[model samples]
Every structure is written in C-alpha cells, then in structure tokens.
Target: MIYEICVDSVAGVRAAKEAGAHRAELCANLLEGGTTPSLGLIRAARRVTGIGIHVIIRPRGGDFLFDDDEYAIMQTDIAAARQEGADGVVIGLLTAEGDVDAERTRALIALARPLSVTFHRAFDMARDPFAALETLISLGVDRILTSGQEASVLEGLPLISELIKRAGERIIIMPGGGITPRNAGRIVQAAHPKETHFAALTAEPGGMRFRRDHVFMGGELRPPEFDRLVTSGQIIRTVMKNTTG
Candidate 1:
C-alpha cells in the first residue's frame, strides 16, 4: 500500500520524506483546506526529497467553482509545477451546476503535459460522483482523490469499493480523508486501491501558541489549542515498514 501524506509546509515535506511516505501532496493553509504552495516551496521540496511531489493547483479556499481569472491562475500553476520538476499535479474544478467542469479541467490537463494529473477531492462535492468519475476518466485524469462522498473514508468505503470496481483499468481510485494508520489496512483491503492518502499528525502535547494577555470583548481567552503531529519521519518509516513488510 502506497502512503501519500499531505504537507502544508516545506518542513512537513521533509518530515514526510524521512517518515517513508511515498509522496507528499504539497499545499499551503491546510486550515483553509489546502491551496497552492508558493513556487519557492515547490522548488525547495524537489531539491530536498526524492519522493513524488504532487502540487495542489487550487487558487483559493472556498468553493470549487473557479472564475476565469482563477482558471488562468491554475494554468500558470500547472506550468510552474512542471518547471519545478514536480512529478504530478492535483487539481479540482466544478461547473456552476455542481458537476465536473470537464472542458476547463481538460485545458489544465493539456498544460500539465508531462506531469500526471489527479483530480482532487472536489469530487466529494459533486452532484453525482459516479458520473463525475466517468468524466474524469474520459478527460484522461491519472487518478481521483476522493473520500467516497462522505466526511470520512470509513463512512464511504462501500462506495469507494464500487468506484474501484467500476474504474477497473480506466483510472485509479485513491481514497483520502480521515485515513489513519489503524484503519489504513482496512480501507486498502476494502477498496483494493493502488494507493491511499492521509495526514497522520499526533497532538504535539503543547504546540499551540497564543497570547495569555489577549482576550475577547468578554475578557475570555479566544481558545486553547494543541500542537498536532505533522507525520514525523519516524512514524512514516514505521508505518511503511509495517505496511510493506
């Protein structure tokens, strides 16, 4: 089973490589659901890790619908990914009607040229996943990163299995979202996919930073937070050894 870990920063990408992750989904602002990382980060990741770098080509945080300008930005990002020696590009786009925007996606794919393309999780929000998968395959997408149309993979395993079966040799069905080491094996067994994606971060015991003097109008601290694991190199190595052994 191949493990594709999400990395929101250059440090996270390096950590993922140390942990034995097969690939890193390069993005920024994970809190905003992952936007495109900067060109410098992309180049730095390539120089630092030999593992596959799949750059997320998303322009912003909200909604999958892209304006013409955003679409143009995606095109530039795709070309930049290629110039940076990225292995592949991950992107998602939908029509205003909540369906796959095949025409626009095809345009981006054409610009991607030599790099592989994996349609991102915008698949989960589609009006009809099965139909959308068909469209992605027809567009020659290398893969689809989906959560089976639910909040988590465990909840969507049944549909994911169906998608895998339907996909056959046409395209790859890569499952993501809430995939943990404990359930990774189970999901792989159920979906029988060629790969899987997960962000395995352990709570860092006291990593959240805040100003103690800072308070809201009511004189209460905003909220306490904790540090989360960015998927340590050690964890990745152990998981890989366990899974591949």
Candidate 2:
C-alpha cells in the first residue's frame, strides 16, 4: 500500500520519510483544512526528504469555490511549487452549482504538467460523487483524496470502496480524513484501496518560557497559544505496521 502523510512542516516531512511514507502532502494552516505552503517551506522540504513532496495549492481555507482572484493566485502557486522542485501538487475547484469546475480545473492541470496532480478533498463537497469521479477521470487527474462525502473515512468506507472499484485503472481514489492507526487496518481491509492519506499528528508544547495568559492572537475559535501539532514518526510507524501486518 502507498502511504501518503499530510504534513505542514519540513520536520514533518523528515519524520514521514524516516517512518517509511511514500509521499507527503505539504501544506500550511492545517487547522483550516490546509492551505498552500510558503515557497521556502516547499524548497526546504524537497532538500531534506527523499519522499515525494506534493504541495497543496489552496490560497486560503473555507470552500473550494474560488473567485477569479483566488484562481489567479492558485495558478501562481502552482508555478512556484514547480520552481521549488516539488514532486506534485494537490488542488481542487468547484462551480457554484456544486460540480467540478472543469474549465478552470483543466487549466490548472495543464499548468501542472509533468508534476503529479491530486484532486483534494473538495471531492467530498461535490454534488454528485459518481459524476465528479467521471469528470476527474476525463480531466486526467492522477488521484483523488476524499472521505466519501462524509465527515470521516470510517463513515464513508462504503462509498470509498465503490469509488475505487469504479475508478479501476483510469484514476486513483485515495481515502483520507480521521484515519488513525486504530482504524487504519480496518479501512484497508474493507476499502481495499491502493493508497491512503492521513496525518498522524501529536500535540507538543511550543517554545515559550513566558507568556501572558490573558491575550489571544486569533478570533473566538482560537487554538491554544502554547501548543502546536506535529507529525509523530512513531505513530506513523505504528500505523504502517497495523496497515500491512
């Protein structure tokens, strides 16, 4: 099985490589479901890890329906990912009507040529899963990361399995979201997918010896100021063992 880990840092990429992951989907602001990472981060990850680095090309978080300005930004980001020597790029776009934006998506795919392209979890938000699958196949997307239009992979296993069967040799259907070591084996056994994506993250205390507890950097829904999430090599290793053994 191909293990693709979603990571947000060069350290995370290194951890994934040491733990035997085949690839890392590099991103930033993962709390908001991942955004395009900085060029420096992409370049550093490429230099530090031998595993494939597929950068997420999202300009911001929220929905996959990007405005024209955001679409232009995505195009620029794809070019930057290529210039930074990234192995692949993950992207997604949708029409207002909830279908794949074939026109814009096709342009992005054309720009990402030679580099592998993965249609990200926006597939979950699509109006019709089967129709979206066919469109992606026709657009020549290399793979699709989805949770079967549900909140998590476990809840979406039935649809994921069917998508894999339908895709056959045309495109790859990669299951992702809420995939932990505890359920990794079960997912593989049931879905029988060729590839899977997940983040084996652990929270670590940030490096701040002194802090003002009363202050908040973000708005109402803010994360803890002194804690940060990082990928755990041990967790990845355990998941790998559970998945294949």
Candidate 3:
C-alpha cells in the first residue's frame, strides 16, 4: 500500500519523507480545503524531500467551476509545477451542469505532459462517480482521489470498493478524506486500493506570547491563529502500519 500524505508546508514534505510516505501532495490554505502551493514552496519542498511531489493545481476554493482566467492560472501553475521538477500534479475541473469539463480538463492534461495527474477530490463533487470515472479514464488521468461522493472515505467505502472493482486496471481509485489510523486499515481491507491519501496533521502553538481578542484572519472555522498546522511523522507511521499490516 502507498501512503500518500497531503501536505501544505515544506516542513510537512520533510516530515512525510521521514515517516516513510511514498508520496506527498503539496497544496496551501488547507482551511479552504487546499489550493495551489506557491512555486517557491514547491521548489523548497523538492529540495528538502526525495518523495514524489504531487502539487495541487486548484486556483481557489468554494467551487470546482472555474472561469477563463482561473483556467489560465491553472495552466500556468501546472507549468510551474513541472518547471520546478515536481513528480506529478493534482487537478480537477467541472461544468456548471455538474459534469466533468472534459474539454478544458483534457487541455490541461496535455499541458501537464509527462507529469502524472491525479483527478483530485473534485471527483467527490461530481454529479455521478461512474460517469466521471469513465471520463477520467478516457482522458488518461493517472488516478482519481475520491471519497465516493461522500463526506468521508469511511462513509463511502462501499462505493469506493465498487469503483475499485469496476476500475480493474483501467485507472487508479485512491481513497482519501477523513482517513485516520483506526479506519485506514478498514478502508484498505474494504476498498483494496493500491494507494490512500491522508494528512496526518497536528497543530502546534504559535510563537507569539501576546493575547488578542475578537479577531480572526478567516471567514470560516479557522485553526487558532497562534497554532500552526503541520504533518506528524508519528501519525504517518501509525496509519501506514495499520493499512499495510
């Protein structure tokens, strides 16, 4: 089993390597459910870790539908990811009608070239998983990181198993989302996937000693401003053992 750790920081990249992860999907703004990481961060992560770097190519959060400018930005980001020696990238696009934007998606896949592309969790937001899976397979996507169109992988394991069985050798169905050590083994046993993705993140108190009130940098539930989120090597090893054993 390949433990693909989702990371939002360069430190997380190093931690993933230390914990024996097979790959790390790099992104930023986890509070917004992960956007594209900066080119600098991608390069820094490459310098620090030897594991596969799969950068997320999301232009923003909130919706999978992107405008022309957003599509342009995604194209640029994919180029930057390759220029920085990234091993692969993660991307997804959808139509307003809740279907895969195959035209634009195929264009981006063409631009991404030799880098392996995993259709990200936007697969979960699709109106239909089986249809989207077929679309991805036809477009030559390397994998699909999905939670079976549910809130969590465990909640959608049955669908994941079905997708995996149907997928056969056509494409990879990598289960991710709210996967923890306790349930990682269960997911592996049920889904029987070749790969799984999780963050294994922990929060550490910020360095500031001063106190403030009634202030926040985010619009939604945010991690404590004084707490920095990071990947935990212990959690990585724990989940890996549970899944692989």
Candidate 4:
C-alpha cells in the first residue's frame, strides 16, 4: 500500500522521503488538526522532496463549516499550491448541517484540476458517510481520507471496510488518524484500502535555549512552550514496514 505521511514542516517532508514514504501531506499546526502551510513552506518542501507533496488547503482549524471569505481563501490557497508546484490539494467543506458542500467542493476540485484532489478527514465529520461518499463520487473526488467517523480508524473499522467495499473503484477510501505501527497492519488488513495516511511524529525540545513559560500560545495541555513536534524517521519506517510487510 502507498503511504502518505502527514507533515507540518519541510523538515518532515524530507524525513518522509528518507524514511520510505510515497508521499507527504504538507500542513501546518498539526496541533489544530492541520491548516494550510505557508507558501514559502510549500516551495521549500517542493524543492527538497522528490516525492509527491499534497497540500492541505484548510484556512484554519476548528470546523469544516466555512464562510464566504474563508471559501475564497481556500480557493486562493489551491491556486497557490498549483503554482507553487504541489502535486495535489486536500480539502473539505461541509454545510451547517454536517453534509458535503457540493457546490463549493466542485468548484475547488475544478480549480485543482490535473493535480490530485483528496477530500480530507472532513468525511469523518459528515452526518452520513454513505451520503458523503455519493456526493464525493459525483463531484469526481480522487480520494478520501477518513477515520471511519470515529475517534480513530480502529474504532471505525467496520464502516471503513464497508465504505471500501461499497466505493469499489468509484473513489479511493484512505484510512487516517491514530494509525500506529502496532495497529497499522490490522487497519490495512481490515480496511483493505489502496492508500493510508499517518504521522509518525514525536516531540523534541525547541531550539530556544532561554525560555519563558508564563504565556501559552495554544491550550494549557499543549507541550511546554519550548517543545515542538517533528516527524520521527524511525517511527515512519516502522509503520511503513508493518503496514506493507
């Protein structure tokens, strides 16, 4: 199976390539799930990694419900990804009622032509996975990254397997979220998906020697201010070997 390593930095993309991954999904702030990485980051990753670089076009974290301006920003990011030499774009838009935003989705897919388009884990948040699958298929979505609408793919294996069976060749169902080396084989065996998404990330101390911990940029539980997340090459290799072995 082909693996798409989720990465937040150009460094992670390089690590993925070194660790035997087929592609890397470039995003920022993986803490908030994943937001659009900076254009500079996109170019840097493209330059450094020969493997495919699929950029996540999310404007921010939180919900998939986007307003008009946010939608416009996503469009701009898609265009930028294309111009900046990304291999594909990952995006998702849901209506207020937790359904696919067909019109908006179609528009983005059209804009991302030639380059691949994956409807991201926003599929997991849909009201009905079956209905969402139909909408994506009708829109010509190339692939879908989902966790089976549960906290993790393991919890949603039944639905994931069913979706893979029902989708047939019409759409690609890629399992993502909380897939570790220990469970990668089981997930692949159960879901039987062509592609899989994972992040072999670990926290390392930040470069700053002198630190101030009084203020927190994110939530209280976030890693100490001096700690940052990075892709673990060893973990990536282990996950890949287990899943594909």
Which numbered prediction scores highest in TM-score against the true structure? 2
- What are the C-alpha RMSDs, in order, of all predicted structures? 3.3, 0.7, 1.1, 1.2
lDDT of 4 by residue, 87-197 (tens): 999999999999999999999999999899999999999999999999999999999999999999999999999999999999999999999999999998877899999
Better-scoring candidate (TM-score), 2 or 3:
2
TM-score attained by model 4: 0.97
Tell me the TM-score of each prediction against the true structure: 0.89, 0.99, 0.97, 0.97
lDDT of 2 by residue, 1-245 (tens): 99999999999999999999999999999989999999889989999757999999999999999998999999999999998899999999999889999999999999998999999999999999999999999999999999999999999999999999999999999999999989999999999988999998999999999998889999999899989999999999998899899
Candidate 3 per-residue C-alpha lDDT over 115-203 given as tens digits, one digit per residue, 9 for 90 to 100: 99999998998998899999999999999999988899999999999999999999999999999988999989888899999999888
Per model, how many backbone clashes are there? 6, 0, 1, 0
lDDT of each: 0.85, 0.95, 0.92, 0.93
Model 3 misplaced stretches (Cα beyond 4 Å): none
Model 1 lDDT per residue over 1-245, tens place: 77898887677788887777789999986767799999999998898756889999999999999998998899999999999999999999999888999999999989997888999899999999989999999999999999999999999999999999999999999999987667766777677788888776654555445545444333243223443446566666655554554
Positional deviation of residue 130's Cα in model 3 after best superposition, in angstroms? 0.8
